[model samples]
Target: MSVSKLAQERLGDYILKYCLLFEINIFYFTFHTTELRSKHSTKYFLLCCFQTCFHALCRKFPPSVNYRKRFLTELIRRQETVDHAPLDELYDALADVVGAEEKSECYKSYLLPCGDTVSLLENVALISEGTTGLVTWEAALYLAEWALDHQQVFTGRTILELGSGVGFTGITICRSCSPKKFIFSDCHTTVLEKLRDNVQLNGLTEKMSPAVSVEELDWMTVTKEQIKEMEVNTVIAADVVYHPDIVESLVKLLSKILSGSAEGAPKILICSTIRNSETYSGFKQQLEAAGISHHVITGPVRKVFPYNRDSFIEMITLYK
Candidate 1:
């Protein structure tokens, strides 16, 4: 059910008061936000109680069926407010990119596809929003785009994306050129819903239809079936280099997925920002030492997100 603005405002404000009063750490988020440090505050104090409560409520409640209107409103508002973008705007932007010239359409602000059924197809969509777990499209696009530049090399190739958050990078290429079979991998089942929704949001069913195949390829828990199912010829990862501790393990997972190529040697494209630069470096060195070959197209954009001038995304295209 839809929460009215009046009720939401009241509940949100009330929740904010109670939570912030209950936990004073929220003010720190507002105060510390200007430091150029990107820290997400899930637990805000009383003043931000609604934010937390809202998320918790949504999680408790299944995906809201009545959110179409709300999301439509949000999508429009987001496109207009990109200079001062909100989470919704990023999602709309990610959903709006179209391929094949004028052959694309959007339902409201989201792209509309030919059908609801999904199969392995490589299409590209804008990846925006996602400031949480997955790599931000703002940081991941450069790498995906680079792969697009080489699209002729891998057209109709089987592709896979691990930890595909909101799926901007993967969807974008799929729309640009039709790939034979495609797989989208993510660790979180919740975000995968959005990822599937996003694939449909872009008019890509005829181009690269949705495939039921979302695998939980946690870097630490990757399995052979996951790799076999993925069977991707080209793999791309973006903004995943921030977690230094798992760099080696993450690369290992990539190794497993990419190891199946018998013909032309598999290729992998990775773009990441260095929250854990030293560890990321270690991962890179290890990948190189393995006889696996790769080309580093770009590296972390040091400025800030979206607005970072001279901020280049880190990219690595690996082959074995």
Candidate 2:
């Protein structure tokens, strides 16, 4: 392959991975000054990179205003160095990007496979209000995509989501799937507050069929009454199996719910991004010990959400 083609491919791959994940520092490193100076087709390469980056940011809903501003600022600087007259369209696009209100919290929109968009407001910080549930994790996106692919399983069923971080998966399911009722449960105060806002932000406030509800569920201290009251025919959770104690508490809660759930036998779907091998293995071991069986679901070929392909997300369904 030609050197110019190789460089263009490399830059495209880098931007798609880092920029989509909001990794601003990595984006700069990928497009470092030394590499740009060395390339002979500097103008073409820079323009391609700028156009590609701009399109990617826009495609990924709830575009990160801060990241877009930083990316455009650097692109403008580089364009000025290469050509005395930068593109007027670039400046206009930058102004529109600047119009995105800077705030501690922001919305992210995801275009579902069913032609529906899911938008959520997330904390700028990864960890906020003493919990790491303020933002949409890759596993949540993974599960949401999986649910979209198999809507038949959720149609007309009462679905309950545990650890509904910012309500991404739940809201997506609520909008895309025909669930009879949707319940979002979280233990943290701030997480629950934001989850409700996200549910409303999607204009899902009408108390029609598939009525949406939020509940404060402490897995460690949950009561039997709460489990019985859920009346959920299906339970789903994403990115909730990070810590060992959490795994045990979550397993206990699931066992209690499965043992006494009035919905006969509820389907349980858990999607987890395996950051730690031990944590994932521990979760499986606990499920085996509890006599619950799980099956891994295959992922779809088409992309529904903009997330890293190498995130190693896994989706599993549990049966009693």
lDDT by residue for model 1 over 1-320, one digit each (tens)?
Answer: 33345544554544433222122222232322221112222112212323432334322321222232333344334334333434543343234432213211121111113212112221222332333433234555465445555667457787777677766666655665467766766776556665666666555553434332445567887675656655567776777766556677877776776565545446777777555557777887878776667786654332211223345446668877
- Please, what are the lDDT tens digits per residue for candidate 2 over residues 180-299? 999999999999999888888787764866798888999999876777787889999999998887898888888887886765868888889999999999999999999888999897
Error of 2 at 162 (Å): 0.4
RMSD of 1: 15.6
> After superposition, which runs of candidate 2 have C-alpha atoms over 4 Å from their true positions?
1-62, 74-84, 92-102
How does model 1 score by TM-score? 0.52
lDDT of 1 at 52: 34
Q: The CA-based lDDT of model 2 is what?
A: 0.76
> Candidate 1: worst 10 consecutive residues by lDDT?
103-112
- List TM-scores for all candidates, in order: 0.52, 0.77
Candidate maximizing TM-score:
2
